[model samples]
Target: MSTNAYRGALLGIVAALLLANPAYVGLVMDEPRERSPTGYTATAITPTNASDQRTVVNRVGEEEVLTVAQLEDANEYSPYGPRYRAPERAAESLRAAVESGTARTTGEGVTFTLRRVGANYRYLRTHADDSDAARYHRFDVVRTNGSTVVTTTRVNRSTVAQYLVYKDARLYTALPEYQRETVDEVIAADEYGYRPYNDEFHEVTESVVVKNGTYYVFTTGVHVDDFGPSTKTVVSLLLAALGTLALVTSIGFTLRATRERRDG
Candidate 1:
């Protein structure tokens, strides 16, 4: 009875902590029709000032180097600059191409294909070595249709693990609405697969369709990825620290209560 009571209390504490977390907790149902039966098309987003952006593909789990485009100028290369082409513009072009069946995404043994997904402003981070880098967040997709499940670790702006399993449209149609919805959210979160069930990160991950109008708020200095999960090492260390603190505090209190009982 004592052990049961302690376990219950511990769970209660965990629930309260998670409830206090700002990131909203979402529940997944069994509806499988949430996935959209849409095909993708590739659009060459070339800049007036062509620069080199390498498109890497891993086929059959074997890394393959595709043709890399060279950029001669940054002025008109990507609208958002060579760093980023702006999310809205890229999203618009890609969506249109796929809808028209102009952008047919294909490749065998290809687990991940990162076409020049529209480049977005990713804070150009600098290293301590005085080196400079212009990094941008890209929007990429993993093709799947029922029998061909493509699951990716979403790394957007959030604190959850998003596992997207894409298959044939025919297979997607058979999924229950809720199940499909869950899968869509997972893909949207992209890389959120790093942490799927954490509720205290203040990062709400809503699995969504690529076309869905979901965006993340940005903060200056350190733009926390509001889309994907954090590194596993960092997350695990945080949990361990919290666990140790909780255990110490609980033991201290129990010992104090036992001492009082003896004294009385």
Candidate 2:
């Protein structure tokens, strides 16, 4: 009935609500500036008619969202195309990959959209000791393909030559120099294994642009380094632990105060 009691009750309710949903407290940190320019760029890849595979000419702001297939056709039968995959990487890491100076890009005009290029190991298992047994390659993709590449790492550490059981070869790719370094490191990871790593990463790309009537979006996410939505999960958990501690401390102090007032 007292004003103090009412105030305590109100504080308790407010704290409960905040602890329940982090978004309510604006606990979800958004990094619009940190997002990749190329992420979520393809806004209109919907097939215009269900009867045909044809896509509609939908505009996402100033840019037109065309599928990789459509762009390839416009240029030629270029093997390089767009793809959509899970998880996103940081621009810094992307830059590092390119800086390693191993990536090479090769494709005639249209098919030349290999955002990533790397090697595959067919006989990697037999030659586990040899990181240079897999054949190096790079992919060139073009419009509307909706391509997504996932790079993973394993603690066990193996090479493409080991996983695919390919004959003697080394890790390599064709892209901007640094980009190739990224591919080489990932393909050389121990955890990336039989399954793709892209499925588990969080996306943080800010914007995507197709300049000169065509563009390429390249990205790679590394474990314990760059995380996506899953990273949010980790944050949420840590906050919850703090919330629990707060609740306990608040209750303990409240009870102590009550006892001292009664004794006085």
Candidate 3:
């Protein structure tokens, strides 16, 4: 009818189109879905009859990343640290093998085990490379000059004892005679659905919890979220109410404008 009425109608149509657009609807009307519950709360840890002094040697996974310095510092020295083959011991072993008629005649491809494999420091004297020193304990059995084979160093000593080992964002603690419990269900419920499985990453705390003098360790980065089922439902209802109000107000405006035009 009038220019003002036509302009108002055009704006209403544009607004309605924008609100009903499929892309807009898809973006804003995403069906609320469940999110992975991760992380842990302090309350999740409790006391139990399970002994705290539990010893777990292979608790660390193979995928865990460790620097050379970290590995070496884990104990007295790195497990993969440098090792040395003593020249005197090597010669003696070869001599003994020859006396026993086990030595090769050509002095090539001779292989024998020497009990006196020197420490990492001995290898450091000859090798200038820092990497070579880092791998002093682990030796490679290699073939050299066609027939000669090089063997790794060896020792008759038992494995070292370590109570704590932390690498690659993971910490393992082995204590004796302590008792503790892990309440995952309680934690999940209380913390609003964050549940961490065994050995999974948890970001809630840097220090492991010790329950009643017992020790517990959490692995990986854990996160806690405020959004859950109740939150989703409230948001959805609020959006629906706003949308209904917008629609009703637009219809009222149109009707009132048309009535005014007819009266005029």
lDDT of 3 by residue, 215-252 (tens): 44444235555554464455655555665566666666
lDDT of 1 by residue, 1-264 (tens): 355346545755764554333332223222222222221111121112122011101110011111112111222556764543333333333343433423333443222222332122211111111112321122234344622221222122111111111110123344456544434444444332222222322211211122223212111112233434434434544555665666566565556556666776
Which candidate achieves the best TM-score against the true structure? 3
Sort every candidate by lDDT, greatest first.
3, 2, 1
Query: Where does candidate 2 have its weakest 10-residue lDDT segment?
Result: 53-62
TM-score of each: 0.18, 0.23, 0.29
- TM-score for candidate 3, please give it: 0.29
lDDT of each: 0.29, 0.31, 0.36
lDDT (0-100) at residue 52 of candidate 1? 8
Q: Between the candidate structures 1 and 3, which one is better when assessed by TM-score? A: 3
Candidate 2 runs further than 4 Å off: 1-14, 22-229
How well does candidate 2 score on lDDT at residue 155? 16
Give candidate 2's total backbone clashes.
67
